[model samples]
Target: MSSETRNTANAPRPTASEPAPGSRPTATRRQVLAGSGAAAAIAFTGAFSELFAGTAAARGHGGYGPLVPDPDGLLDLPKGFRYRVLSREGDPLRSGEGEVPSNHDGMAAFAGRHGRVHLVRNHENRVTAKIGVPTVEGLTYDPAAKGGCTSLELDGRNKVLGERVAIAGTAVNCAGGPTPWRTWLTCEETEDRAGTNGYAKDHGFVFEVDGADPRRTGAVPLTAMGRFQHEAVAVDPGSGIVYETEDAFDRPFGLFYRFLPARPLGGTGSLRAGGALEAMRVPDLPDLSSVQETGARFDRVEWVPVPDPLAAGTPIRLQDFGPKGITHAQKLEGCYWGGSSVYFVSSFARSDEGSAADHYGQVWRYEPQKRRLTLVVIFGPDTDIQLPGESPDNICLAADGGLMVCEDGGGAQHVLGVTRRGEVYAMARGRQNIGTPEEPEWGEFAGVTFSPDGSTMYVNCYTPGTTFAVTGPWC
Candidate 1:
């Protein structure tokens, strides 16, 4: 990694319990969640701010108590909460196109016509996968690639109305974000090019999926967004700027990117017109995990343009970036837009992997207005894998004003909740036995999204491909 810190003087260090040089004291969790400095404060920005505001408005208390074990050995939840399996791998679809593809990954929910909800889900399968997304007419991107997205429709009662292939033939369709115009930006988490592994066309691009009308989703890749191992994206509602995360784990690591559209707020097909793709830089900080302090603030944040977003030859991360090389992180995953900032996650980092520092996980808030970045949440390297504060992957602002986080770590898998007070609770657990009876294995949860009305929570189990609708007294 580059040792350049041309802008290190701009960053001011502060502990969570202390205030910056001359700024006001940071709000306590109680004060922040109590509607005081809920949105403006850096501690409660992005999904944290949204969670604080929503929970404060609803007068919510410490998360929904503790999680109760499930007798079915499927999903364990709170006492009042319950989960229903909406779909599973090999499940027959109402459209009769094919069965639900495996590797259920990232997803988003949008309001459908006449009191209905449409969910666009990704299948993180590769070329060799057996149960690949069905190649539907007008929806197939690369017929040789096997991963894509499926759209599911549900009535007001949460009953399945229909299911169809929203986009097909893309590779490693991982996590993505929902657009304000009611569409899902599905990301391909691969960098395979044409003639690679029987691929018919180049992979690794963002494709817009219209949950309401699949026909409107022409399976076109947004090349302007750049080609890399894209993990997830969060679109700024007001600016229409798309913030993306790269999950590459090689030497140089992956970078955090943002795409400024040529035609902002132009809805669905606007991204295809082309735009500027840039990688983030934090002056002197070369790797993200190096910042250990929770309240660490980088005031002079910068974005370096990607010489070639298409990566025709060298990958973006390996590309030259003058003297100050682009900043990178180990496992950059899961991104979401909330309040006036964009929140992104660094799943974990290790010194063995050439990282500046080791950490269990981190949630960073970036404010485009001020061009500032703050480290709001940081899980220490000593975190217990059995606990709820480890390796948070896909994240979403809960309806009740807490952040819904999915566990993608080593130990037991869980759908955890992070309250404004920094309290972590297990909201749901997986009981699948991928191992022997003596050593039962579990799958990590992903795509933790909420319905438009906030009445239901939808998530996916990566293994065995299960989509669940969880509901109960949210507050």
Candidate 2:
């Protein structure tokens, strides 16, 4: 499923690859896409493409400088930056149920009681995995399943207080979104049903995890979110609408979905109340990867009702959607809400795999008010997997109003930062050799998120399953 090995031998580097960091400063969260500031407006709009195209040899963004080698052979960061390993796979948890699960994927940090922070982390494990989430009785939805989420309690100084299984018995908990009502929505990235792979229940569904209180979290699935290969999700604060991404690569590809909850923002278990699920249809466009031009704008967008969200019969994407078929994209990975637009990522596309076109990656911004979706960032094909902008996944709005993107492209893994001026820079690197030292294999970084105050960053290494809290000087 990793795009690192894709054939990009003759592909051109993306226009936005490298740019010098200058006098421009980071924009605030509200200014990111509001078009209220010059830097914010130009950063994502078509102006960015023009700026990159005009510069022939520009390479630098005011990122913390080059990453210094880590003495521990794990993570590398800028000179002044420091990181602490909060949890690792096989480490004993405080709950005494089992060790920390493997394959850490998507995560979120929330404000906990008494000056503490709670991180709800996801373990992308399946039934065959050696280390799965601890199957706690009441918290376990299916003992046959091995993927779920765990909550780590940390003090103000980023010290781990306790770690417990928040939810278990799910499968492939890849990514989910933090709600406006102060909870984490953990999503299952599989469509396996009961009896399939020995699962006691359906696998592909969303579950709510209580960040403030792990004991209150349960393994109840939000069935209406549409059962599919879910990757990540983002919630609109104003509308309380949950926008989800499907990371499916089947014949029909994946569709972008929006769930209109019946009881929006009604605290913890509200999503279980169920809602209407619909897929986005861009009028004439059936496949989004065909859009090669940066800043391609879709003025009018329509939402098609998903007839069978539960997928008890046929999968949602295979269902009929009238003469005007629904729009689909390849490798839809991450979703995050910024300003008024909900941004999502298409990790990459391959023409040979039934895609209409191919590209390194694309980031899209969808505004509900305008009912429009715009291509904000596009990465042209490149031969180098080390490039910071390839196969971006699990993105987050940086505390400085920029974007923090996790690289899933093979080779050496990295956490990349994109400035408001469309400049890309390396923020961190995974130096741990998962394979033999003679033949190193770096794991991808996922769940890049900032604390409520934006002082620390929490990320996970997909292999070895290590969680890190990084602190550094910010702009």
Candidate 3:
């Protein structure tokens, strides 16, 4: 998409008294602090103020607990916690035919009866040789093909109650958002291709699956969500608006996008039938190519709306606004909707020399009311703020009001927690080496979600894939 397209969607307007659809009701100052638990946590860590001197200053209110790495070939967390292997990359297919695939990324949990929860998770494999094709118990997959989805049931104790494959022949299943209606939107991040064997038209669309039924088919791709290298999705519950991030690290990419359902509150059961896909562009920075090539920082940002988001699927170029006003730091990925603002993180940036920015990652917040964007955090290649380059993937909000960032950078991969006050703490470090892209140890921590009550945390690894449950004293 073009810069003009992006800006049109994010144009700033005068602040209005009326809040956005899902904006929380205004609370008294005392209520806000009491609700956040920030003050109490800070006070509990009284010595934290002294530790906040230099790089330690960045370690906000929360501190790291002991790491309980499990080498027994099973996932484990803190002492009070326990985890079950909900699913694995190459487990025998419940469909009674093939095997489950690998590269699991994002996932969502839904409440089930009797204290059970249903999980709908994504497999990011693009039908490769190493990992064979995915097929459900009753379904079938060509031996040569791969890529699919899975559904599983876990009880309160984090034990896998049941498991099954939902869809197959998909590709690059990345981070997807959950709809207010409770279905999981599994996104395929690649365009379909026609080969000698047949046409694979299931790629590059959002497919909604029944979170409860793993064997149930009827998985339909929502063409309205746009076809791109999708990374993550965040939804505004009241408005039913879906905000999505694209993982286009290579070249010619667009900005973050928002989809307004054509039926307003529609798409509960079907996403393809309705919705207008719009890409964001900053009107102030109309000429992105020139700005990026010249290495100029266009501090002013705006959101422009895209006229034709689905035009990408057609042969003709739709609304081509050449790279102007766009920045090299445009690879928008990992977004979570929270705190009256949308928090997003960029994986990395390409420097003026065409080399990747060293430890260049930014956490940005989008204020819907002001239509404003702010740079909340920037990481450098130092010890305190050290970040794996090119792999800052998924993020989740902590009960303590901080961010749980899943680092995807090779060897430096880790699950880092960044508090709202700007303290960074390593929650869990991947077993992978920092500089090499060897098969990620501890897998790439992508999918992260807290239980409804915010007591337990669930994390997933993308390669050598496994899901872990981490519980602690939130009370």
What range of 10 consecutive residues in model 3 has the weakest lDDT sum?
A: 1-10
Model 1 agreement with the true structure over 285-375: per-residue lDDT tens digits = 8888787766667777778889999999999999998798889999999898777788899988989889998887788888787777877
RMSD of each: 9.7, 10.2, 10.7
- The better candidate by lDDT, 1 or 3, is 1
Per-residue lDDT of model 3, residues 1-475, tens digit only: 0001000001222233332232221212110011111111100111111111212124245445544565543442333444445566667655455566677788877888898887777888754436744554343232233665677777777667676676666677788877767777777666554452343453566767776764343555566777666767887656667788776545554457777766545445545556667565554443122221111222334444554555545511135445643333445678877745666777656555343443345555665656655444444333222333234677777655555777766444566665445445556544433234544344578888777666667778777676666666543
Q: Across residues 90-189, which tens digit of lDDT does each residue of candidate 2 receive?
A: 9898778889899999999999789899999999998878799989878898999899898889898888888899998899999998998778989888
Give the whole-model CA lDDT for all candidates, comma-separated: 0.80, 0.78, 0.56
Worst 10 residues of 2 by lDDT: 1-10
Pick the winner on TM-score between candidates 1 and 2.
1
Question: lDDT ranking from best to worst?
Answer: 1, 2, 3
Candidate of highest TM-score: 1
- Candidate 3 backbone clash number: 29
TM-score rank order = 1, 2, 3
After superposition, the stretches of candidate 1 with alpha carbons farther than 4 Å from their true spots are 1-59, 381-383
What TM-score quantifies how close candidate 1 is to the native fold?
Answer: 0.89
